[model samples]
Target chain A: MVKLTADNIEMRFGERLLYRFQHLSLAQNQTIHLQGDNGSGKTTLMKMFAGLIAPSSGEINIQGADSLPWWRRNPLLGKAVYLHQHPYLFEGSVAANLSYVHSLCEGDKATIMARTEQAAKLAQLDHLMQQNAANLSGGERQRLAIARAWIMQPKLLMLDEPTSNMDKLSQELVLTLIKDLQKQGTGMLISSHQACVLTQLCNQMWKIEQQGLTSTQHTPTMAKYSNTGQSQEFSYVTAS
Target chain B: MNDGWLALIQQALSLLFSLDPEVWSIVSVSFSVSFAALAITLIPSLILGFILAFGRFPGRWLVTNLIQTLQSIPTVVIGLLVYLMLTRMGPLGDLKWLFTQKGMILGQMLICAPVLVAMSQAAFTSVDRRAWETSRTLGASWARAVWTVCRELKVPLLMAIVAAFSRILTEVGCSMMVGGNIADVTRNIPTAIALETSKGDFAQAIALGLVLLILSLVLNFTLGTLRGKAEPRSH
Candidate 1:
């Protein structure tokens, strides 16, 4: 089942063009890795795909929803979620952050509570439920954010640099949780610099090159050793 | 240092603490008028501030600049403009609100609306844009997203409210011109202070001054407390 489709997507700020895409589509349970340099418009594309931003000229249809301006009143809501590189942890306990996602639904209190608990455990945040999310360490906050997003059970989840600030252990845990979500049929688009690790879970790889999206399939490994003896894999996809 | 000054201050304190009826009456009127003005402008100012902060439209900069400019305009100029409007020969004459508490409220509201708008806009602008996007991505309505942003900015919003309140509460020019300083009706604290001082009734003037000083201190204290509460949660 197709979860989302974008046709002729283009984004520009005034006279400066950011990116343009001919077409893109996501199927149920598909995981796509998006790789790009710092200023290559990767985050902007994800935001537009999630309906958080309007494209300069294009149509992005999510779950057959009409197009941009997908308001909360739109039924397409609760079906998609986007996590920023540095997600905002609201001014409250970590539990409150998880509960916020459940609050948006129309379920009974007990059912929502169960889901929140389940999400917390999945993200390995069950012990930090009472802690203030704002004061949490970077990895814990990212885990909390993922748990919060999972509780909503969005069909399509877009994550920007979900593991950038995480330690190797934390990154492994996050990828494990994401793999679990994929098994349950959650389509995902992830933007990250850790290509070797992320590509392992990706079925499709997309990169921004020459102001447009370039598609590739997952390679056996993007782990290439550089002359400096550092493990740098993916080529830096800079803007033209 | 002077015995006469100390004596006058003592008399003023005695009258203030003794619940002098005439002095209390002016204080009551002051509170009522300023509170009314704030109540009238609060909702509209918040709405305009949010629009200015987040809404993308042509001429947004012009509107923001206009509100900022209005905030710095002299209170007496606003008083004079409102006076012309409320005078018998002016456009709003038929309301017959001149020299009434309502007229003072109207003048104060005029002075406060832009002040509230400018400050609240700055507060809203300071909120992380990610908050809005995250809320919407989580299925919050636009209004709910805006409300969440406001929740995140409770401290700054309170400061804006306190600022607008203080500006109208202590301003004498608008109150004097439009309220006409009528005793038992429009004789608010600032107008009363001005009148009493000119009339050489130092006791009354000093008492009103003391009241203003306490009010300002209380407001700053509350602002400081809010800042303390907000620091840990703010990013």
Candidate 2:
């Protein structure tokens, strides 16, 4: 099955054109990691592929549907979930938050609870479900975000900085979930500055630089070589 | 007048609870017109504010500054400006909305639209960009993205509405001039206060004042609750 394709997608921010994409595709069951300096349009690229944005000048065909320039939502897209760097948690119970935008139909109370339980187990968020999502710690937030995506059973999963707020242990758990997703034939795209995200699990890694995306590989020297060498190369940071 | 304090207190209490057809008329009219005007401006201001804050359109700053200046223009000035164009002799005279509830609603919308735009824009602008990006990547449509942003900023939006409501409710000049404070017709809280005080009905004036205070309190309480729950990426 064709996973996803963004053909010649161009996005402009005012006079500055941000990205020009030509033939980017993800195969079913493949994992791709996106990397970039701050404001290099990594998030924009991810959002474009996620179908959240209109490319200024191109088309994004997903799962065989003709790419739409305007807002496009599909029931199948629910089969693909995007977890933002900072997940937008609704004001509600933990279970309610987990079910947000997720269309798990015809399920009884027990089934819903079971699925919720399973998702929490993968994200290790079971203990925190009853807690107010607003008060969750950073690590806890990431876990809940992933757990929500996990419950949706998306064929395509995209995560932006899933472990930015987590410690080594939490990051390891996130990576483990990615491994499971790839094993289950879910194509995953992760945008991260962290070296760990571009693991052996990811078949390809790409980086955004000067308004363009170039293929990158995180060798063993990823940590020591990444930001330290190009400290001055990217002086501008995207204000959160 | 002889029992000044007692009479004032009684008069105030009476004006508050008496709820004569006139008082009820005024109260209902006030709410209806202000509510109508607010409803009319809600979507426009929201969309304008959203685009101004988040969109990369040219001359966006000019629009923002112009709106800010318009917001600071006094309510009386707004009433005068509209009164001119809407008068029997003015351009849009055929509508015959002058001194009518609809007229007042139009005038007040002019007053409140800016507040709604500036405040709501600030609120929406304050929402984390991640929320927008996340919603976008989820393959949500523009409408869905806007709805997501609105939901995320619902607390602020609520507060902005209350602020606009309270601002219009207490302004005497517009309701008086534009609504003409017609007895048992277009009279509202502020206009009623003016009429009662001018007619030496200090007791009634005090009563209307008390009601206005209570209304303001309710509005504030609602805004406070929404602000509390509107956790905008506090984490």
lDDT tens digits by residue: candidate 2, B39-120? 9988899899899888898899999999999989989998998899789999989999999988999999999989999999
Please give the lDDT score at residue B50 for candidate 2. Answer: 91
Residue-level lDDT tens digits of model 2 in A156-226: 88778776756756666676677777777878877876555434456577777777777643333232223
Q: For every model shown, what is its TM-score relative to the native structure?
A: 0.90, 0.82
lDDT of 2: 0.73
- Alpha carbon lDDT at B18, candidate 2: 69
Off by over 4 Å in 2: A6-23, A34-44, A52-60, A63-81, A104-114, A191-198, A207-240, B1-3, B229-232
Model 1 residue B70 lDDT score: 93
The two-chain DockQ for each candidate, comma-separated, is 0.49, 0.28
iRMS of each prediction: 2.2, 3.4
